[model samples]
Target: MSNYSTTTLVMTRVFNVSREKVFDAWLNPKMMKKWLFTLEGTNKVAQNDPQVGGTWEIVDHRDGKDYRAIGEYLEIDPPKKLVLTFKMPQFSDTVDTITVQLKELEQGCEMTFTQDIIVPHEETWTEADIEKALGEYHDGSEHGWNLMFMGLKELVETGQISYKG
Candidate 1:
């Protein structure tokens, strides 16, 4: 019985590309700018130092607002596995952990993304508020990641970035 609530989000997508190419997209600044930020914003800043203990940050600007995400690499196994800390300071104060695993298939590579979010308790938050907030966060995260993955697949396969919106 942990005091904090944990929400885990998992998504898997197969890219029609080699494992190395698929893995490189997550770390390469140029590739990340092209596919990683698919929400309403455009990526304004993308910086990545892909190594154990290295940090990365991206800023997306849209509608006169800036959305920033920062993280540090925890574990990096080239073209195979990556574990990192993900934080969106504008949204939440809690830091989340994201683990990405890549497996090479006969045709392409399959990537699995898992995010574990720790929901903190606030004195002013009622049960209903907490539930609603968590639900929205979960849904938004799923949708956003799915869209980004679609863009990633397109970029890695056809060398084009296509966003649904």
Candidate 2:
């Protein structure tokens, strides 16, 4: 038996738009910055190469700090599914995997997003430290995703960006 556990965040949201539009939002630089990282910051970089084995990098400057994330596309199926490796060096060295699946609906599309993260166990980590780390990670991820999805729904449905910062 292994003494390791995985930290996973699963989220689902339905958008009133075509599957293609919803899918493109994940790759399109303009659409991504509008919804994905609309915080009070300047998007210094939004380079996306949406192809198998292709990599992407985004850097956002906020409040004298830089938040950057880099990833590579593992799988890409148009308007349906995408799998990628995500890493934020500012946070941790561990690389996480994200899987996004889009299903066509009667009115629009439904998106199922999942992020699988491996939280390594360290000899110096106590139980409380582990719990705290896990809780923070989950909360941060959930909050960010929820806000991003809200922006996405608004953008795709109304052709407007709600959160401008």
Candidate 3:
């Protein structure tokens, strides 16, 4: 197997919601539609099968284009930990894995989100080029996840959330 460089993007958030509720948001189609990562789009397709090996897919319809996020569950421990693959076929063929770990707090819970970003080096690309590309991906991903986290916070806190909000 070829060894490629890997970088992790880690983010943590304290949600004022129970662990199960926060964890369920990652699996439920309705909740996922409201808070999962997406570009600027009002229409979304969220199909999730919350099981050890089941796959989940989300498609965002925006500006006459569909952006799909597809993945398979690698591990699932209710209200505690979840591991899954995440890939956007519209962009790159590289597959990445994400882990969501939730710890119950006195009031609510803290979620630690981790994603492994494997840098794909093209034959003609230099080391600097690879590093630059990785930076862009990391920054863009962090921004998108932050937006989705905001929506999630709203959904769990207020029982309603929207992409536009």
What are the per-residue Cα lDDT tens digits for candidate 3 across 1-165?
Answer: 154567789999999989999999999887887778652245467888899999999888777788899999999999899999999988878899999999999999999999998777777888898888789878888988888898888889898875463
**Measured by TM-score, how close is model 3 to the native structure?**
0.92
C-alpha root-mean-square deviation, candidate 2: 2.6
Once fitted onto the true fold, the runs of candidate 2 whose alpha carbons sit more than 4 angstroms away are 1-5, 38-41
lDDT per prediction? 0.84, 0.84, 0.86
Model 1 weakest lDDT span, ten residues long: 34-43
User: What range of 10 consecutive residues in model 2 has the weakest lDDT sum?
Assistant: 33-42
Compared with the true structure, model 2 gives a TM-score of 0.89
What's the CA error at residue 132 for candidate 1, in Å? 4.1
Q: How well does each candidate superpose onto the true structure, as a TM-score?
A: 0.88, 0.89, 0.92
Best model number under TM-score: 3
Off by over 4 Å in 3: 1-3, 38-41, 162-165
Summing lDDT over every window of 10 consecutive residues in candidate 3, give the lowest-scoring window: 35-44
